[model samples]
Target: MTGLVEYAERHPWLTDAIVVAALLGSGVLGVHLVGPGDSRPEDVWVADAVTVVACLAVFGARTHPRATVVVTTVCAVVGGGLGFLLTPLLLAPVMVALYWLAVTTTSRTAWTYGAVTIVLVVGTAVGADIDETVALRSVGPALWLVLPLVMGSRSRLRDALLDAVRARAEHAERTRDDEARLRVTEERMRIARDLHDVVAHHLAVANAQAGTAAHLLRRSPELTQKVLADLQTTTSAVMLELRDTVGVLRNGGADEDGLEPAPGLARLPELIEACASAGLTVDVEVDGEPRELPAGIDLTAYRIVQEALTNATKYSASGSASLRLGYGARLIIAVANETRPGDPGAGRPGYGIVGMRERAHAVGGDLRVSDAGGRFEVVSSLPLHTPAATP
Candidate 1:
């Protein structure tokens, strides 16, 4: 049934041809059944001619619905005047045209056309002094026209609902794609920040150690060997950390063997020792008891300290710095170093400070950088409880 309906919609001409054939065949049969006693030769010819013309009008119903309705209505009225034998067959085309009009046009237009056609046909029969019984019999033709219009209206409503549903589905798909792209952009930015921290800290230390080793090579061979060893260790650690960070990006955060856990507050001593090996003496102090912290907060605190110390080692004139950790309701990390001679402030604003500020803010913390009377200081305070906590 669905396949036939689809075929009719696709090739309306074929549907019209089928309807014309049926109506012509029925008219021929009706005339023969009536015999010469009923319809004369002239009457038969008029009936057949009206049926053919009416069915042909149905071909344009889809494209020119109102015009088709007018043409077929006239054909129906003329056939009704001829005799009862021709009325039923001629009315088939009228019914098809009414259905097409309802489907293609607004309700007002279709209903108006249907009402006018019915009144004209019945009124003409009565005015001509046709019997009241025959005029009342035209009710069957009226019903045929009304039923198709109702069905056509229903079909039009169904198509509108389907189109709305399809539009909503397409909008939902586009929203999903936009969200996926946003997530990818955020992940790339996170990776870039991590890469900057790892490279900046280790390279600064390696550069200092290499310079010291070259200066002491002949006069102090023994100290030069130790500095060279520290340089090798710093560069190797930098390589390993870089590989692990990149691996996290490649594997989409899944753990891999041989990948070390990220450094945190507990690794502060090791960080200071690396600075000391690079010829920078850093004195450490703590004000409260230390406890385990949230993973994001711990990593953020470590990064803040590493960046501050790297700046101190690279720019301080005194070759010494100080670190203080205050563990209370909140964790406070502070690092300060003396400025080089004639230097006004913490050398200059750069990515290290920006990256530190970003990391602090990401973990719901805040950071401040200051230059007070030759001492360059960085202080960061983080909340004890964080969203990324492993509870």
Candidate 2:
């Protein structure tokens, strides 16, 4: 039985083979017992032959269960004229075929088979010349046939429902996995850009400063010390920020110790000071009450200002930018700059702009970047609390 199940699992054809074999074997057995002292040999033989053909149809039961039931039922009805002896026990194969069909097909089909089974069994019992006791007892067996049919149909339905649920669960899991992979890929790309902007740029500046210090070390020790001190400050800041960012990733974001809080409107003064050191003058302004905002909004506000200032420094010859922050129900941030004439980078936006837009949108906000009358502006506004945070 285990071998048969294994074979059926591996090869669907085996299921059909088993059905055919069962029907044919049952037919032969029924045919052998159809003869008795109560029935004529010719009549018994004819009935047995018809039953054998009908039962043999069980071979294609799964493929054509309705047809098999129809054929077997008709044969069973006609064979009644030959008495119980001629009929043999060929009804067993018919019962098995009908029950299997009910189990595999829809409920409507099962109902139809059940109605037919009831009619045929009752008609066969009543039409035959069997004793009253035997005829009465036959009803029990006829009713028993319905148990397998109903139970089998129910079992198959349950299995199909379970399979559907499992399929949906697997599909959901696959979708989640795909989204996670995409997010990771984007994060890696962002990290690469940050490394280029922060680490590479600072390292280049530090190297230049160190070279200057070396060149003046003997002749102007005071100048050398100043240059070296600036280099040390720049290098140290880079190392600290790098350690924080990389450490966050390496530790799965659990390490907050050396990590600086994300820059926000609160850090605008420091940002202005930093711009001064870089020879860029920034005018910072704040309007409206500075209420505490959601973390996402705060982070987005900071990034918008940072990206705008960075672009201004890289592309504007005027070395002057304006940073504005306003808080109402929403936080608004805007950075505008006077673009440098003949600066190729002034007109084109890069991933920094894209990152700013993405950050704004991530917090259910909007970002707008445009050039107006030779001035470039990046504006972003984010709601303090989104629908998801309303609880």
Candidate 3:
């Protein structure tokens, strides 16, 4: 059945021709089976002609439904008026035309056309003095007109519902694709930020240590050896951190052998030790009891402190800095160092400050940089109840 429907859709004209031939055959057969044998030769020929004309009109119903309905209706009424009502098979084309109109037109137009067809056929039968009850004559034609119209209207409604469902499915697919693309873009930005922080902080420390070792090579062999040792340590640590960071990107969060957890506030002492090796002394102070923190906030806090210490070691003239951590409704981190008159690293163009500020804002916090009163200071505060914090 499905295959036949598909074929008919593909070859509509051929399908229509086949339908016309079938109706023509039915009309001719119906006439011979029920037509009166006592009728004159001229009357028989006229009845056959009327049946042929009515069946042929169905061929044009699909293309011009309203016009075809009018033509076929007139033919059916005329056939009845001429005493061609033996089998009522001449009304087949009118049924086909009404169905076409119902499927292609509005419900009002289809119903109106159907009503007009019934009135004309029944009126013609009654006016022609046919020897039959009015209700019996009317029943067959009424069913013929109404059934096809009802079936066609149902088909139209089904097609409309299918179109709506298909449209909604297409819209949902587009939304899914857009969300996937957005996630990919966000992942790329996160990787870029991590790369900047890792490379900038480690490279700055390595450069300072290398310079010191080179300057003291001829003056003090022991001091030079210590400086070179520190450089090696700094480079090795940088390599390990870089490997872990890059592995997170390559492996997509899968655990690997010797993979360490990300650095957080607990690693601040280690950061301070690394700065001390680069000829910078840091004095630390803490107020209020420190407690557990969410992973995102903890990581953000560690990175901000690490970046500020790196800057102080590279730019301060006094080779010393101060750091304070205050815990309460908010965690406040402050790092301060004396400004150097001609420090090369004081106004260096880099993303370290920007990255810190972005990290703070991401966790519902803020950071401030100040170079007033002959001192450079970085102060950042993060709320304990941030969106990223533990529930």
Q: How much does candidate 3 score in TM-score? A: 0.76
Task: Count backbone clashes in candidate 2.
Answer: 0
State the lDDT of candidate 1 residue by residue for 241-319, as single tens digits.
8888877767768575666677898898899999998889999999999899987889899999999999998988889
lDDT (CA) for every model shown?
0.82, 0.71, 0.83
What ranges in model 1 sit over 4 Å off? 1-53, 73-89, 105-143, 172-180, 215-223, 246-257, 280-291, 317-391
Best by lDDT: 3
Give the TM-score of each candidate: 0.69, 0.80, 0.76
Model 2 earns a TM-score of: 0.80
RMSD of each: 5.5, 4.6, 4.5
Predicted structure 1: lDDT: 0.82
Off by over 4 Å in 3: 29-60, 86-88, 106-133, 215-224, 248-253, 279-288, 311-391
lDDT of 3 by residue, 188-284 (tens): 7677778877877788788888887888999999999998898898899889888888787787784756776778999988888778777789999
Question: Which ten residues in a row are the worst by lDDT in model 1?
Answer: 30-39
